[model samples]
Target: MEGVVSVNPNHVCKLHTTRSWDFLNLTLKDVGSPQESDVIIGLLDTGIWPEHPSFNDTGLGPPPSKWKGACTGQNFTCNNKIIGARYYNSDNSSDISDIQSPRDSIGHGTHTASTSGGVEVAGASYFGLAEGIARGGVPKSRIAVYKVCWAFGCSYADILKAFDDAIADGVDIISVSLGSPWPSDYFDDPIAIGSFHAMKNGILTSNSAGNSGPNPVTVSNFAPWSLTVAASSIDRKFVARMELGDGQILAGTVINAFDLNGTSYPLIWGGDGANYTIGSSPDIARYCLNGAMSTDKVAGKIVFCEAGLDGSGVLAANGVGTIMSDALIVNPDYSFSWPLPATLISPEDGKTVLDYIRSTESPTATIFFSNAWKDVMAPKVVSFSSRGPSAISPDILKPDITAPGVDILAGWSPLAPSTVYQDDTRSTLYNIISGTSMSCPHASGAAAFVKAAHPNWSPAAIKSALMTTAHVLDPSKHEDLEFSYGSGQINPLAARDPGLVFDASETDYINFLCKQGYNTSTLRLVTGDNSTCNNIKPGRGWDLNYPSFSLYVKDGEKISAIFTRTVTNVGAANSSYTVTFDMPPLISVTVEPPVLVFSYVGESNTFTVNVTGPVISQWPITSGSIKWMDGTHVVRTPLVVYNYLPGAPYNLDSEQAYTMTRESLGLTHSNVYHKTGMGQSRAHPQFL
Candidate 1:
């Protein structure tokens, strides 16, 4: 990736890119055949490296096959050489659809695009997205590069324009590797609205879940329409950095997991500055090593600030002595350092080092503090990513999955414009980068591959394939929380072959809308609002709804929404699978198309369910219980109850069916219903 930028020395770029959990599960053979699947993928980033050797390969070809400008009012041909790139900076004279968008101003875009769809690098191939040498998840997929993000940061309008261009160009997948700190208001932010539109049109939109680590809230891609991806560090046995100590800043030994001051080192409590804060002034805040620097009150030695305080840049700038922090920096250990000294310690070794520095009284009275990345062994989530209870609808799930984020090696511009330079090395070549930005392209490429294999699969089906096929359990994490890893890791192989899926249709969305108290008039109003903003609540039918699988099925008297999912191998197109669902005591779920059957491969099915009760589950539904199941495998949806019954019955003439949903399940409430049959004796049912 290459791009121009507005220089801001204090601004910290988002670290950590998103990649798949099954990055190692794919091989070159899976996508090696040239043009086998002519799916077009849109990359919305700084840009791509049109001249990279990887672009010369059969699968990862040059522009015409790589780029497309098929949208109305747009003339960008899918010509390999057309280069329909655009510069968003006001300083640049370029406008939308300039056909020169292929040029990467910043190396980040190029790297991400390369990782997702790059040609194989001899032995290095196995190191990227999948173990397959010379193959991305979707090697044969064409690209529609949307150069939306310029160094000043992508504007909502720029992002919106990119989406419209990409969608009009008919790209199968849209990958956005950039993020903004601003909150996503429903009325503004055309990018979010545009993403929702893309998904409505069956385009798979993938975005970075932001690099905000360890926080359960950060929502990078808040729009429900896009696949918001979080990042995880690639499990390289060793990650190395240079310790800058004037003459002492030598290349350090590389270790996968290291020990700090014994005590099994970090035990995971390291990385970023989750625990400590580094003062901006030139102060000796803390020290990591005992003898590294002696504190002379007169001759101020160095301070070893904790990792999460300021940032790597700030910590290094103080020029205090050598301080040690977790290795959260995304770039490779280039020969760059702050005026102060610094070194990176592994998370596994953080505790003991902090303990030693604190316990031992060295003549160098440097400050030593033990800052952790939330918990022991837990990786720090990057800061730029958005937090959840998403601004749009906190109840709905936004970031559907998480993937490898740290130190990802992708494509880069061989000759970058100077504005993006932290130094010449950063400016002129392919380097490893991290963040949700990196992870999204990986998914977008994978989506292209999925589209080729199952051309007819809806975005929901594709999403299901990606999520259900993902490896939720990574050996790398300490406790292996699902909140962190999400549907495990994305497994393209399993996704490619996911037998059957729960199909969500337009009606399913209508039901969901109704459950949300949106009637036809209100729905129309919302849709009209979206016309101007392009961001609105999903309305009835297929074209208006955002992502998330929704299936409509028949219930007793009315239609209910039943979300059905398929597992691997258990329910194929030709097989009959017995389906059964038991509702929680208080809530009732009616399954539509309850008896799911598939006639041929790639055919999808659905079930309808009516939820009647409080929005909260009467009893917490364990992971797989409320979800659709095919034999032993289970697919899960972060449960969101859209409907709840009114608490008390009104008088016979009273139209008192309206009620507010209880905030929590633990709250006490009364339930009252009017007696049926007016002629019969009056009777009351006690409400819980």
Candidate 2:
């Protein structure tokens, strides 16, 4: 009992699973150094494909002297680059098809592991698409794979055990691309519990924000101890072009690898093949649900179907391809990849396709292979990346930052199919996928990048560097503001040399836990020490020395809160930083000291931010920033004030929140995710 930490009933968590380093202007030449090779990144996911070129240790030195991990599973080999390998299935519920070894059978683990600290593989891609040199943000960093997920979903028992092992294994950082379906108490969540220990051990844990998004209060992995990452676009976008016989061209956001060899195929509306005799409705056929379409009619035709539908019927009926018309989340729908040649177009374009199909006696169409298009309006938080005002801790922001997560081409396991569909026998060594899972590893790599440059920095210090030096995002592009992308998209180059950091220690976090309402007994279970709440009232997160400031206010109540923060100078000695702020006209914010002058590096400075505003009735949330600028560096901290109205139409209480699904969230891209609970093609669950 004395040795045991907190215990919880087993709960299942699902797996979640990048791109453009050039978009961040991070070239290989300026990226890694000998110090980077000393850092080790531990990944808790499905597993890894060590045989892949991404794990090659060619010309690399042996593991560091502090390395204390080993290869603990069969059928897996670890090199200097991947110094550790272990697997867990404490639930004993893996499918018979699943291999118990650390070798990845689901591509999610391999993809994420490579995205975090993979060696550069030249000319890597998925079927020649997204072709480029595949490398991680910290390519020289070592990777330690801890297989915690499986076909039956990741059990909390295994997840916790993994954390126990990884933290003791001398890992510098932990990357987890998995989460539970819903928010739970900090003590009840395995990630929150695991990461608390990781933080105490001077290891930063990077986790996914989840795929449930375009919806408020859906962020997962929201604990303050972990770095929750959101998915965002890079400069590249994939589009599948459709050419109609009438000389009209329609482009849809998708990843279609199959080529028709420039030949056109007959096109037909999915509704035309409805099995009316079997009580199948036109809507059912139009959506292309299985058993609704007649095979004879749709075979060899490119079926036109409504978007957000499984469209599995088309494949089942031997249809060559599909054209999906998506009406929701327009301005180019979420990009997805299916086994067959397919494309997802806007509803308006779909109307044109339907018209051509109905008017032409013998309609014809062609879907070209997906091509990469440059998107100028990128770095936008993706629609699937979870939104925040954390369901667990609303006052403290979740999704600490954003990273390149969409359409990331990374290492893959040949044991798994290229597509999520099991029917497709295609296999590849590199695949493109999207999720906060991908983004978490990117953040992990960035954290390692910073750790390499500042080896003495703590986990909180590394997180502060990443958050303060991030690239600012446009509020106009995101509806939820900071809730959508956290501080901003990551800037690995700038993060390495952040002028200052807001570092917190184990004692500070214990105090924060007390403020969050953890009693003495519960605190001891978590901290493994006799820590007391000391009569601290449960309240907003104003005391934690976080890099960002966020206040949650009631809808009608006056917005008045004071935040006291401390910054540690890690830049040039004898430098001074003058404070500047940009806030809305309705809000008044002031800092006690106008400037901070540090006579030497590692010197600490304290400041207090006082904000007062009239009741904000028209706006749900308003944001500003506090910048401490010197001639050489600018340290930025985002400020967010949200009027969170209880029992609002969209807000859900803990008792009522469990029932809310992506379906309830209204037309979230249901087909895109690749959960451990694998779906039958375009029907994956939201957790992964």
Candidate 3:
């Protein structure tokens, strides 16, 4: 207890993709992976299905010499491709569906493990949908599985233990696909603490951004030492169609693999078959709320449940088919196959179908099989990928980059059900799933690729390569800019040879934590060395050697701040770099000594970007980027200025209040003060 800084609940974190390599152009034939045979990617999830073809060792050599891990799971074997396998359940937790060893029963671990470094598997498909050669970013990279999650979700203690084992086990990159309900302090978060240790040992940890998105401030992995990945899309999508009697076709969402062969079924509204004690009531039966429909009335009829997931209800009533409606799902590009002849239509479509049914005495419709199509809006961040302006570190950007997460086809366990619907009894080797969980492994594999090419690079350097060399996303699609997509979607090949990398060492992170308010002695509890916060500069966040820059200003405050950043050149020798800015609206940004000349590789250059602008009144946020171009390679990172609240004061009365300390922010800063209520400042909390 003496060394304990804080106590956190052993909160059970939830488990949160596919193609997608070809979408990024990291194809099996095109990708020139350099010596990736030795790179080991450690996965922390449920567990792996060792017998899956994706884990086949075929041409792979033995484990890397640096791999000090072991296969400790009972009855679980690790091949040359998967160098190690182990499982952790500190609470000895068990579910009826859980397996007792590292063997995956839930399939999440297998899905993620193979997604990160699975061997190339030909004829890989999800029930003949989105069919293609399933492959990871670096197919040749070795995998080490650490199963920390179970049926009840991942325990923080187990997660911490897995992190400890992963670090000690000599993993080159750690891929964690689970996270807490919310991000805690770095010292308190198991992933953060473990990743910090991993970073110290030259291992980069890539974590999911959490699947609570389309909503802001939901990111759960925000530690600067690790990479927090957001979820995006690839170039593909899926849909199902329903045809009315008049031949009017309505495209809906559902992976209906079942083919009715153009057979029309009589349509009956749920209300017509209401099992109400008071007799037929369309209003009550409309939702088809479990057992609401009468079996005799709905039997052999295509039931139209106005707005509900009454697939089971319809089935119990002996309905041949069902049409459901959801008002919320608008233009969603993903769907899953249901066991029955089913399709989910939009609320507007539901109304039109209801009208068609009313107008015709005998309404009939046919549901067709699911089909695949190209989505022009591919690579847009999915609605479920968590958003951020991190609560842990406001100045630093979270979800460092976006990767393909929606509808990812990867290795799955035969022990688990393929789709979310339990009634569907179909099983498969690979399953299509979506979440930030899928995106994390893509980034991890990419990081492995970069690390394999540049073995001498630090964890931070590899991260910088991925971030700076990423493809800049369309600002029109990502209105939140860096907060939503970070440095944009990852580009692994470009990352292998990033011209410049914003590298940060242990001391740099210590300073970042110091700026986040950790005092010297408390910080010692973490670093366990003679680390001090004395060198911490007076800033909310920009002082750290982060890839991007973010500043917070209050309403009508004259914007002024200075950000100093350092970059280590990893490009060609005798390279000259000059900075260019996509300046934010109505804000002036100037970089001093803009030209950075690197005499040789690994040479470091530091630059200070100063800003002095007129009183700005943008209530929410505006973002831009600066590119350091050397004519051959361009290194880019986002620059943002925002004011979350127009005239709001520092909220100190909340249920979970964020109270800043003077020793951390007040005593060290130029414009420091203790605010009892709402106050205004040039550089305040950046929340929107």
Candidate achieving the largest lDDT: 2
What is the alpha-carbon lDDT for the whole of candidate 1?
A: 0.44
Clash totals, every prediction? 97, 1, 6
Q: Which ten residues in a row have the lowest lDDT in candidate 3?
A: 679-688
TM-scores of the candidates are: 0.62, 0.94, 0.91
Task: Compute the lDDT for candidate 3.
Answer: 0.78
Backbone clashes in model 2, listed as residue pairs: 18-408
Q: Return the number of clashes found in candidate 1.
A: 97
Q: Tell me the tens digit of each residue's lDDT in model 2 across 1-688.
A: 6667676778898776535777777788877688999999999988899889999999889999988988977777888988998998877777754888888887888888888898899999788798879998888999998988887789898888899899988999999999987777777788888899899899999999987776777788988878999999888889999999888999988888889987899999988989787898788788887788888888999989875444467888899999987555356434667778988887889999999998999999999999998878898988778788786577687779999888788898887767645556678999887778888999998999988988889999999999999999999999888999999999999998899999999888888888877788777767766678887877667989989988887757788999999999999989999999999888899997989999999999999999999876545778999999998888988999887634332323343454444445452344333211123233222225
Q: Which digits, one per residue and each the tens of the lDDT, describe model 1 over residues 34-92?
A: 44345767777766666665555443345444344632223223334213444343335
- Pick the winner on lDDT between candidates 1 and 2: 2
List lDDT for all candidates, in order.
Answer: 0.44, 0.82, 0.78
Local accuracy of candidate 3 as per-residue lDDT tens digits, 506-604: 988888778767888767656656788886654577778989887777777887889999989888989999989988566888997889999998899
The best candidate in terms of TM-score: 2
Instruction: Rate residue 527 of model 2 by lDDT.
Output: 70
Give the Cα-based TM-score of candidate 2 against the true structure: 0.94
